[model samples]
Structure formats: structure tokens, C-alpha cells
Target: MTRIVLLGGGVGGSMVSNQLARQLKPEILRGEVEITVINESDTHVYQPYFLYMAFDQAVPADAKRPERAVLNNQIKLVVGHAERVDREAKDVVMGDGAHIPYDYLVIATGSRPAPETVPGLVEGGHIFYTEEGALKLRDALAEFTGGRVLVTVGVPHKCPVAPVEFTLMVRDWLDTHGFESSEVLYTYPIGRLHSLEPVAAWATEIFDQRRIDSRTFFNVETVDSEKKTVTTLEGDTVSYDLLVAIPPHLGQDIVKRSGLGDAGNWIATDRHSLLMQGTDNIYVLGDATNLPISKAGSTAHFQADVVSSNLVNRIHGGLGSVRYDGKVFCFIEAGNDEATYVKFDYQHPPKPQPPTEMIHLYKLAFNKMYWLSAAGIL
Candidate 1:
């Protein structure tokens, strides 16, 4: 029997397991293959919904579901933390001292915001990446009357356009709440509003129209909670009454501890094959990998298909022909009621698309489809 073990039961992990379960059904039913997924939490969170949850547009309860409920019954689920990967022995070291053996290993543990990299960031700024953070920010936003509102981005953050979306949403919220005196300012580490050229061009016009001050090349160095001040690496400083910061992101600690990560603590994999750089039996997906693409859920969704096909081919003693082309699709919210769509791949860059209420509706529909399909309820 082939023991296939998946680490991290997040979006990418769940999707890969679902596809693998279907592809290897014959072997699974005959007891020739066994699949197990290990995750730290018992609940699966719909992270994208957290944005709406912040504004009270979506309930918190609707954003989470039991992890087991979303997975196939045939796949074994283990609730534990992954300590390290023992590639030499083909085993996964669990936090509780158990070694889970595997013939094939899949690393899908995604990245998380690392606020520790910037001194005083966690103490001073409000971040909206998690449920608790978003909820806290919601209260902060409600209590805010009028002052400088700053939204700063840490480079290479997940969902590249999210900071821009948040800036737009906050502007609308201030306008609706009669806080016309409040000023909204945005800053990026790089020298552009967005990494994608076309999207940046579109965003420039939008920022101008909204009168949102955007400062580029302002890499954060430290934040002072006492004075509510942000200092950039080049010695530029900005003060704010309310600060929304996107902290630097890093991969799972286990990946780096296992010596499987690059200098930035991300798994180095072939951009096309999604296979670990130095190992044949190990594969990586989602934000954990050091791929030159946006670390969005859509990227993981597209990569899941490629990884699944490659795994099947390897299992059958054949080299996989399928390759990932760095495909990514994003829906950028203009405000509360309108959004824009951008699609691109390695061969092509994003082209500008006008924001529309219909695209916003499509985004709402996608949120529903994501939960339904992930739980196999649709």
C-alpha cells in the first residue's frame, strides 16, 4: 500500500486531497492506497470572507466549518501540528513525537503574516488578515471619527490587490459615516501601486480620483505605537490616527526547520512542475512555495490541478507532462458594490478591466461556491 500524507489542511491542501481522492479512488477502495491529512486546527476557515466579516457584511460563523466536514470520508484526518519533515526516513514528525510514514509527501502549509519582522507593528497597527484581526479592526473603524487613515503594505503579501481594496473600502466607509475630514493614505514597499504593470496603471487613476495619497518605495522599518508613527527604511516617516498594516509574510516554520525552504523560509520548487527543488517524492503548493506569482487562493486552486496530475503520473511510474503556467485570476473590489477582474499567466500580463457591479456579484457568488464545493455539498 502507498501511504500518501498531506501536511496542512488549508485551501490548497483540501483541494489537492479532494482531487487525489477522486483520482485514486480505485486504489483507495481496494486498500492499495491510504491518504491522511494533518492540520493544527479542527476548523477550516474561508479566509476571503474575513474581508466582508470586518465590515459586518458577512457573519463570522459563515466563514468557518469543521475541517472533517469538508474532506472526503475515505481520507483520514489527524488533528496535530507538524513538527518537521524527515525526508531521509520518509516520515513526518508530529509535535506529539509520532512519526507518520509516507511513500509520497505533499506540503501545502500556506504562509502567514509575520509582524515580528517589523518592530512595534503588532503593537501599533491593526491587521485584517485573520478573523480576530478583522473583527478588531471593525470596532476600530466604527469608533474612528476623523484623522489620518493609513494603509501600508508589506511586500509580497498574499492577495496582492487586497490592500488597495481595503483602502477603497475604507474610503467608502468614511464617506458613508460622514467622516469627510478623515484622510486615507496608502504606501507600498515597491515603487508602484501594484506589482502588475497594467493593474498598477488602473489603480493610479483610481487613487487619484479618490484623492487617496499613495507613496511608493516606502518599505517599513519600524512603527511607534505610542505616537502612532511609521518609519520607512529610507528614513521617511508618516503619522496616522489609525494604521492598517499588512505585515511581512513567511512560510511554515516546519518547512524552514526541515531544511526544505529557501533563504526567505519558503519551499523552493520548480515553477512549472510544483515539485520540490531537490526532492523527487515531495511536492509543494500555495503560499509555501517560492514561486514568482501572487499568493492568492486562485493561484493555489489552479496549481492543485497540476500537482494532482503530476502525482498520479508519478504513482504509475510515468513522468508527468502537465505543467503550471503561473495562471492567476483576481477580483479587485472598487468599493462596497463594484469590482474589477484581472486574469493573466506567465506568458501574458494583466490587462485593465473596468470595475462593475456585476463583477462584485460574481465575487459574492464565488464565496458561496468556494464553501459549497470545498465541502462537496454542491
Candidate 2:
């Protein structure tokens, strides 16, 4: 029997496993193939919902579901932490010392925020990356009356547009709560409000209309919690009454420890084929790969389709012909009631669509569609 093991049951892993199960049903039923998924937690979170959850627009329960509830029954689910990959022996070592062997391996362990990398960042800043962090920020925002609200972007973070979304949402929240004295400010390492040229132009116009102060090229060096200040590497300092920071992100420790990661600690893979560099039977997807795309769930959704098709080809002794074109789409929220859509690929950069209430409705509808995706129905 051929054994296939998928690491990290995130969006990429779950989607690929679901597709493989359907495509290889005959082999699975005949007991000629086996599929197993290893994950650290039983819950799967719809991370996009975290933004709405922070502002009391969405319930925390709506953002997550049991992992097993979303995966296909034909696939095996192993709940454990992956320690390391023994590529030479073709085994995955678990934290509890179980060695799972595999004829083929899939790595989808996503990236995570590392706040500790910046001194005092954890203590000084409010973050909304995790469910807990979002809830905490919700409470903090609720108690805020009038002060300087600062949002900073740490380099190479997930959800490239999230910090901007949060700033706009928070600005609206302050206005609605009658905190007219509250000043909303934004800072980024890059020279523009957004990495995409067209989106940045649109965002800059919006920032100007909203009177939101923005400064670019501000690379964060450290945060002084006691003084309520953030210092850049160039020695520029900004003080804040309440700071919201997107912390530095890194790949899973196991990937780095196994020597499968690049110098930045992200897994190296062919941008087109999604195959891990220097390995034939191993593939990568999602935020784990060092691909030049936004580390958003939409990117993972598109990549999952490419990876699934390529994986099936390999299983049948055929070369993977599918090539991912770096396509990504995102719904950028301007405020509580309006949003804009942006779709692009590597060759074609993002062009902003006019912000509308309809797109906001679409974003809401996507939360419902997410479950269908998890169930492999869409």
C-alpha cells in the first residue's frame, strides 16, 4: 500500500487531502493507498473572521470549527505536534516519539507571528493575529476613550492588507464611539501605504480624506512599553497612547530544524510547480513556501488547487504539468459597511475596485462559503 502523510492540517493540507481522497477513491477503497493528516490542534480557524470578531461584528465561535468536522472521513486524522522530518528515512517524527512513514509527504505548516523577536513588542502592543489577541484588542478598544492610536506593520507579515483594514475599521469605531479627539496613525517599513502600487494610491487618497496620519519607511527596532514609544532602526521615535503592531512572522520551527527552510526560515519551493527544492517526493503550499505572493488565505486557496492536481499526477507516474500563476484575490474592508475587491497575479499587479457595500456583503458571504470549501463541496 502507498502511504501519504500531510503535515499541518491548515487550509492547504485540508484542501489537498480532500481532493486526493476523491481522485484516488478507487485505490483507497481497494486498500492500495492510505492518507493520514497530522495536526497540532483539533480546531480549524477561518482567520479572516478574526478582523470582524475584534470589532464585535462577528462572534468568536463563528471563526473556528473542529478539524475532524471539516475533513473527509476517508482520511485519517492524527492529533499531535510534528517534531521533525527525517527525509533520509522518509519518516515524520512526532513530539511523542511516534515515527510515521510515508511514500509521499506534503508540508503545509503555515507561518506564525513572532513578537518576541522585537524587544518589548509583546508587552507594548495590541495584536489581532490570533483569536485570543483579537478578543484582547476588542476589550482594549472598548475601554479606549480618546488617545493616539498607532498601528505599525512589521516586515513580511501575513495578510498584507490587514493592518490597513484594521486602521480604517478602528478609525470608524473611534468616530462612532464619540472619541473625536482620538488620532489614528499608521506606520510601515515600505515606502508606500501598500505594496501594490494601485492599491497604495487608492489607500493614500482615503487616508487623506479620513485625516489618518501615515508615515512610511519606518523600520521598527524596539518598543519601550514604559515610555509608550516605538523606535525605528534609524533612531526615529513615535509615541502612542495605544499601539497596534503586526509582529514579525517566521515559518514553523520544525521546518527550520529539519534544514528544509531558506535563510529566512521559509520552505523553498518552485514558484510554478510547488515542489520543495532539492526533493522529488515532497511538496509545499500556503504560507510555508517562500513564494512572492501575499500570505493570505486566498493565496492558499488558489495554491491548494495547483498542488492537488500536481500531487495526483505524480501518484500516477506522470509529471506534474500544473503551474500556479501566483493569482490572489482579497476583499479590502474600508470600514464596517463597505469593502473593495482586488485580484491580480505576478505579471498583473492589483488594481483597486471602488469600495462598495455590495463587496462588504460578498465578504460576509465568503464566511459561509468557507465551510463548503473545508467540506470539499466548493
Candidate 3:
């Protein structure tokens, strides 16, 4: 039997496994193939909702579902932490010392925020990346009256557009929640408001129109919790009554332990094939790859199509000629119930459209329809 093992239960892994199961239903029924997903958690959380959760617009229940429910019944689900991937032996070593062998491997372990890397950041600033972080930020917002709200961004974080969306939404929130006196100051590590040139230009226009203050080339060095201030590597200190930070992210520890990734734990992957470099049977996707692209859910969904098709074709003695075109789409919330969207591929740059209430409503609908997406029906 051809055994395929997926080493994570995130969006990419779940989608690919489900797609493969659907496409290879005949092979599986004949005892020709098997698919297994090894994940550390029994629950699958839609992380995008954490942004809304911080603003009290969503709850934890809105973001979470049983991992088994999100996956296909035919796929085996293993809930345990992985120790390391044994590439030479072609198996995954579990923390409990179990060896799961595979004819093919898919690494989708995703990424994690490293707030502790920045001194005093864990104690001084608020982050909405995780469920706990979002709930804490929600409590902080509830108690806040009015002050200088600073939003500092770090490099290589997931959900590239979240910081911008949060800034815009918070500005509107302050106005509607009797905190109109609050000042919002945004900062970026690079020399622009955003990494994408077009996005930077678009966000700059919105910031100016909304009277939001911003600074570029501000690399956070440390935070002084007692003083309520942040110091930048450029030798400048800024005071804030409240601080929201998008912390730097790194790949899974198992990737590093297995020596399958760089110092930052990002695995080298073929852009078109989505396969790990120097390997034919191993594929990498989502935030695990070092590809120079936004680590967003849409990217994972797009890559899933390529990987699943290739895997299915290869199992049928095909050359697996399908290639990923680096397609990505993102909804940019512009506040006041208006939103915009940007769609681009490897050869094209995104041009964000004008904000509209209809687009905002579509984004809300998409949130509710995300379960269908996870089920590989959309």
C-alpha cells in the first residue's frame, strides 16, 4: 500500500488530505493506498477569527472545530507531537517514540510567534495571534478609555494584512466606543507602511485620510514595560499608553530538529512544485516554506490544489505536471463596514479596489462559509 503521511493538521494539510481522499477513493477501497495526518492538537482553530475576537466581534467558539470533524473519515488522525522527521528512514518519530512510516510525506507544521525574542514584549505588549492573546487584548480594550495606541509590526508574521486591518478597524472602534480622543500610531520595520509597494501606497492614502499617524523604518529593539515605552534599533524611544505588536514568526521546532530547515526553521521548497528541495516524495506548504510570499490561508488553499493534484496524478503513474502559479487573494477591511480585495499571482502585482460595503458583507459570508472550504467543497 502507498502510505501518505501529513505532518500537520493546519489548513494546507487538511485540505490536501481531503482532496486526495476524494480523488483516490477507488484506490483506497481496493487497499492500494492510505492517508494519515499527524497533528499535535485535537482542535483546529481558524486563526483569522482571532483578529475579530480581540475587538469582541467574534468568540473562541467561532474559530474552533474538532480536528477530526474537519478531516475526511477515511484519513487516519494521530493526535501527538512529533519529535523529528526521519528523512533517511522515511518515517516520522513521535514524542512517545512511535515510528510512523510513509511512502510520501507532506510537511505543513505552520509557524509560531516569538514574542519572547523581543525583550519585555511578552509583559508590555498585546498580541492577537493566539486565542489567549486575543482574549487578553479584548479585556484590555474593554478597560481602556483613551490613550496613544501604538501598533508595531515585525517581519515574517502570518496574515500579512492583519496589522493594517486591525489599525483601520481600531480607529473606527475608538470613534464609536467613546474613545475618540485615542490616538493611533502605526509603525513598520521596513522603509514603508507595508512590504508590498502597492499595499503601502494604498494604506498610506487611507492612513492620511483617516488622520492616523505612522512611521516607517522603526525596528523594535526592546520594550520598557514600566515606562510604557518601546525603543527601536534606530535609537529612538516612543511612549504609548497601549502597545499591540505583531511578533516575529518561526517554523516548527521539529523541522529544525530534523535539519530539514534553515536557522529560522523555514524549509527550502520548489516554488512551482511545492516540493521540498532535493526530494521527490516530500512536499512542503503553508508557513513552513521559505517561499517569498504572504503566509496567508489563501496561499495554503491555492498550494493545496497543486499538491493534491500532483499526488493524485503521480499515484496513477502520471508525471505530476501540475504547477502552482503563486495565486493569492486577500480581503482588506477599510473600516466603517467597507472593505476591499486584492488578487495577484507570481507574474502580477495586486491592485486593491475601492472599499465597498458589499465586499465587507462578502468577507463576512466567507467567514461563515470557511467550513465548506476546509471540507474541500469550495
Candidate 4:
């Protein structure tokens, strides 16, 4: 059996599993071939609409679909947390006392927020990084009348633009809720408003128009929820009534303990090919990889395409033939009625520019597409 083990059950993992199943032949991949995907969670989240568009508390039910629905029937999906990859033994250690061997291992374990890493954060402040966390905020947002609302990003967060997006959406929501006077602030690690140029221009302009206070170049050292204040590494403190903090992300604990990660515990990989260095027969993708692109779903979708093609070629005894372009598309809400999208393909030498409404429509309807795609209907 050609045993293949895929890690994680997120967007990136599900997409590649579907593609690879279509390529690896039944004769070669039948009983002789075993396809296993190890993931911890039972539900898969459509992360795009975690905020405004799908504001209903019940959205998580619709967002998560069965992992088996996304991949073909030939693949065997296992529900468990992988402790570490034993590259020397070609096996994966599960959180439980079990080991799964694999001919080729694909590490798709994604990133996670570490709010507790910040001083006084877990004990003092509130966050909306996960579904449950945001659900708590949903209740918090409803009962609260109005006060200083802060949306701060810790150093190195996935979906880097999300804090800004959430901030604007909440401001709009608050205004609708008759809290127009409530102070809204945006704090970031970067000097500019948005990390990307086109998006930054659009966001900076929105910051002025919507009155979203922008605080740049400040590193969040600790969050004091009880004191209702946030302290920075630069020894400055800011007060907040409600804090929507984006926590620093780290690679899956499995990869970190396996000694496959960098200083921050994110896995190191080829900048272009998405393959694990010093190890063949292994691939890393999305937020888990050391790719120099935004850790958004669009980036994962594009990376999966490249990894899928490359894995197929490698299986056929051909050379690694796929090259991944550092392409990313981000949709920004203009806060009134329209949205702005930005597209970037690193190969082109042109500077970043504002994207058209086509990207907006694409962004809005992505959840539906995601549901269809994840359900294997696509």
C-alpha cells in the first residue's frame, strides 16, 4: 500500500487531499495505497465571515462541514491531534498512544493565536481570535453601551488585515447601535496602517473618514483586562472598554516539538516550492510554511494548487515541476456600502494597486463557494 499521511483538516489540507485523490491512480492507490488525514477538530470553519457578513451567532454551524466531504472517498480521514512527525521512522505520533506510518507526509497543521503570551492578556482582556472567542465577544458587544474600543494586533498575526477589517465593521455596527461617540482605535506593529500598500492607502483613508484612531509601531507587551489597559513593550499604556486583540500566532505544537520550526515555532520550508528542507517526501503549506505571503485562505488556495501539481509529478517519477508564485488577494470593506480588493502576484514588477469590485463579489460569496468546495460538491 502506498501509505500517505496528511496533517490538519483546515482549508489547505482539505483542498490538497481532493486534488491528490484525483491524480493518484486507483490501481496504485487502492488497498496498496492508504490515504490518511489527521486532524484534531471535528468541525472545519469557513474563516472569511467570522465577523460582519455572517454576524449571526449560528454561523459556525453552517461554516463547518465534515472533512470527509471535501476529499474523495478513497482517502481515509482520521480525527486526532498529531503530536509530532517522526521523520526518522516515517511515522506520526498522535496525542493518544498511537502511531501512523506514511510513505509521504504532508504537514498542513495551521497557525494558532497565543493570547496568553502577552502579559495580563488571558487574565485581563477579551479577544476574538477563534469562533468561541468571537462568540463571547458577540454577547459582550450586545450588552455594552459604549466606550473606548481597541483592535490591536500582536506581532506576526495571520490574516494581517483582519484587525483593521474587524475594527471598521465594529465601528459601523456601533454607529448603527447608537454608539457613534464610542472611541475606536487601531494599533499595529507596522508604521503604516495596512501592511500592503494598496490596502494601506485605502485603510488610511478610511481611518481618517471613519475616525478609527491609528497607532503604529507599537508592540503590545501585555494586556491588563482588569485594569482595562494595554501596556506596550515601549512602556506605554492605553485603556480600552472592549479590546478586540489579534494574538501572535505560532505553528502547531507538533511541528515545534518535532524540531521543524523557526524561532517563533513556525515550520521552515522552501520559500518558493513549499517543500520541507532536509526532508524529502514531505510538504508544508499555508500559515504553517515560511512563505512570505499573507496567511489568508486565498494564499492557501493558491499554494494548494502548486503543491497538488508538484505532488502528482513527483509520484509519476518526474522532477518537482510546480513553482508557486507569491500571489495574494485581500478584500477590504470601504465601510459604507462598497468593498475594495487588492491582487498581487510577486513575479510582476509593477507596484500594488487597488482591485476592482470583482474581487469584492468574490470575497462576499467565498463562504458559499467554500461550503460547496469543502462539501466536495465542487
Best by TM-score: 3
Please give the CA lDDT of all the candidate structures.
Answer: 0.88, 0.88, 0.94, 0.76
Regions of candidate 3 where Cα sits further than 4 Å from its true position: none
Which window of ten consecutive residues has the lowest lDDT sum in model 3? 368-377
**RMSD each, Å:** 1.3, 1.1, 0.7, 2.3
Residue 96's lDDT within candidate 1 is: 98
70-126: candidate 3 lDDT, tens digit per residue: 998889999999999999999999999999999999999999999999999999999
Tell me the lDDT of candidate 3. 0.94
Worst 10 residues of 4 by lDDT: 348-357
Q: Please write out the lDDT profile of model 4 over residues 39-107, one tens digit for every residue.
A: 787667777666653234345665677666666787778888788888889999988969999888888
Off by over 4 Å in 2: none
Candidate 4 clashes: the total is 3
Question: Order the candidates by lDDT, highest first — what do you get?
Answer: 3, 2, 1, 4
All candidates' TM-scores? 0.97, 0.98, 0.99, 0.92
Q: Please list the residue runs of candidate 4 whose C-alpha ends up more than 4 Å from where it truly belongs after superposition.
A: 28-32, 53-58, 348-361, 375-378
Assess the local accuracy of residue 224 in candidate 4 as a C-alpha lDDT between 0 and 100: 71
Q: Which candidate should be chosen as best, given lDDT against the real structure?
A: 3
lDDT of 2 by residue, 1-378 (tens): 988899988888898898888898888999988989999999988888888888988878998889999888899999999999999999999999999999889999999988899999999998899888888888888888689999988867889899989988988888889986789999888899887788889889988987789999888899999999999987899999999999989988999888999766799898888889888789898899998788888888888898879878877878978999999998899985889988999899998877899998888998889988866679
lDDT per residue for candidate 1 within 1-378, as digits (tens), equals 998898988888888888888889898999988989999999998888878877777888878889999898888999999899999899999999999999889899999988889999999999999888999998998788789999888966898888888898888888888987789999888888888989888989998987788899989999999999999998998999999998889888998889999777899899998889977788899899999999998898888889878887777778976999999998898885899988999999998687899999999899888976664344
